[model samples]
Target: MSSEEAAPLLCAGIATFNALKKSGAEAGDMVVVQGIGGLGHLALQYARKMGFRVVAVGRGADIAEDALRLGAHVYIDSNKEDAVARLQSLGGARAIVTMISDIEAIAALMGALAPQGRLVLLGAGKNPLPVSAGYLVRGERSILGSITGTPFENERALDFSVLAGVRPRLETVPLERAAEAVARMKSGQATFRMVLTMTEKSHARP
Candidate 1:
C-alpha cells in the first residue's frame, strides 16, 4: 500500500513496471524502453536503479526530462525523431520493455532488439499486435505477456517508490475531477499518473 490515499496512482504503475524490470533487466545493460508515461516512466526509474543504461522513448520532452532526472541515461522524443531508428542506434538492447502495441511501434522495437533479448508487452490497448514472424525468428528473440502486478510485488514497489523518491509526477484531482483524470490518462496526456483524491479522513481506506 502507498503512504497517502492519492498515492494509488503511482502505486499501481510502480507495480507493473517492476515486474518488467525483474523479468528482463540486469546490471550494466543497455535498455531501450518504449512509452514513457504512466507505468512506462516508472519502468525507466526501475531500469536505472538496476544499473541499466536506459533510453526512454516518448512524445513529450517533460517526460524525457523526468526520466533523465529519475536516472535514465537518455530520452528520445519519439514525436520529433524516428522511434525505431532511434532505438536501433542504441545497439543491442537486452530487452524491449514496451507499453505501446501499435502495429509499427511493436514491429520496430522487436526488430531492434538484441539476440536472446525479450520484448515484453505492457500496454492496455485492445489493438492486436501486428508482428511478422521474421521479427521473432531472426535474432532468436522472445516475446513475453506480462500481467499486472501482484500483491507481493506491489509491496516491493511501494517500498522502492518511497525509499527512492520515485514520485510519479502527477496532478491530483478530486472525486469530481475523476472523469477528467481518466480522460488525461486515456488520451496519453497524463505525465506519469493521475491521482484521484478523496477528502475522507486520513487512513480512510482500510
Candidate 2:
C-alpha cells in the first residue's frame, strides 16, 4: 500500500477498535480483561488506550507482569484471591472480555460488572458454559461474541494494532514440532501465542 493509504488504514482501524470501549468505558470507567494471554493482552492495551481504567485478570505472576507491561491499570491474580470481590471494590468494571470459558468464572465476571455493563466473549470454550441468566437480565447487561473483523473491520484492527504497537507475543516452533507447540499452549506455558513455521522444502502437511 502507498504511504497515503497507510495512514487511513491505521486510523480507521484504531478508530474502530476504540469502538469497543464505547457504552461501557467513559473517562472514569473501569474495564476488565478476564485472561491476560494473547487476545486478553490486546484487550488490556485497547482498554487503556481508549481511556478506561483497566483491570487485568488472570492466574499467574508472569501474567501480571505481562498485563502491566500491556498497560493494565491493575492486575487480578485469580488464583490467589476472590476476583469478584477485588473487582467489585474497584467500583466494578463496566465491561469485561470473557477470554476464559469457565462457567463459574464467567458468571462471577458477569456479576462484577456495574449496572448496564457489557461482557464480550472472545475465546473458544473448552466445554459448554453455564452462564447465569440473572446477571444479564437483572443487571441490564449484554453479552456479545466477536469473530474476526469484517474486511473493513479487519483492516481497522490491524490499524489499531499498529497504533497500539500491539502484536501477539509469539513462540515459534518448526512445522515438525506443531503438536508440541499445541501441547505447550494447552498447558498454558506458551506466554501468549504459539506459531508453527515451514521450511522451503516442507510439504503441505494439513
Candidate 3:
C-alpha cells in the first residue's frame, strides 16, 4: 500500500504503537509480542524501533522467520515451547502486548512477565482472562485494555511510520471484492492488512 493509505494505520498501527509507548518498556527491555497477524506485525516493528528487545510469539513455526524479519530478536512457537517458561528463561518480559483475542493465550503470557511488567490487551475478545490474584499481587504486574488513540497520538504514529519505515503489509482489492477480502481475513488467510480500492464505478455512483 502507498504511504497515503492511512486507514489501517489509524486503527491497528496507532493502537499497537500507543500501547508500546505507554508500556513503560525502555530500550533493551525484553518485550513479548503475542500473535503474528495484523496488530502483532506492527507491534513488532514499533517495539524494535522503541529499542525494546522483542520476542515474537505465535501458534506455529510458520511465522517464525516472518517474525524475525519483522525485527523480533527471538521467535517463540507457543505450540512447541512453553511460552511462559521460555520468557522466564530470558529473565521474563517487561511487557507482553497481545493482538489476538484468545483468552487462554493472554492468560498464558501473563505468567511470563517480569515483576511490575504490564500485559497490554489490544484485541477485542468476549472471554475472560483467568489470571490468579497471587500473580498480580506477588509481582505487582498489571493487565490493561487499550482502544484507539487520540488525534495527536495518531499523528505521532504516522510520523513514526514514515521515519522508521514502519509500514503495514497490505493486500489491496477492488471495492467490489470487499467481501472476498473480509472472507480472507476471517479465514486467517490474509497474511497482512486488506485495503479496498475505489473503482471508476464507485466515483460514477452517488
Best by TM-score: 3
| Model 2 worst lDDT window (10 residues) | 197-206
Candidate 2, residues 1-206, lDDT tens digits: the string is: 32322332343333325446444567668888787665675676677777888888888676777788888989889889888899898788788776676766776667688888887776667766666688678878887765444567666666666776655555666778888878988997775655566642322210
**lDDT (10s digit) by residue, model 3, range 37-149:** 98888899999988999999999999998899998999999899898998999999999999889998888788889999999998889988898989899999988888789
Q: What is the lDDT of candidate 2?
A: 0.67
True lDDT of residue 30, candidate 2 = 86
What candidate 1 gets wrong by more than 4 Å, as runs, is 9-11, 60-63, 183-189, 200-206
- TM per candidate: 0.80, 0.76, 0.93
Give per-candidate clash totals.
0, 1, 0
Ranking by TM-score: 3, 1, 2
User: Relative to the unseen true structure, what is the C-alpha lDDT of residue 108 in candidate 2, on a scale of 0 to 100?
Assistant: 66
Q: Where does the lowest 10-residue lDDT sum fall in candidate 1?
A: 197-206
Candidate 2 residue 94 C-alpha distance from true site, Å: 1.1
The CA lDDT at 163 in model 3 is 91
TM-score, cand. 2 vs. native: 0.76
Predicted model with the maximum lDDT: 3
lDDT of 1 by residue, 70-147 (tens): 667988887788766766777777887877757567666666687778877776567677776776788777877775
Ranked by lDDT, the better of candidates 1 and 3 is 3
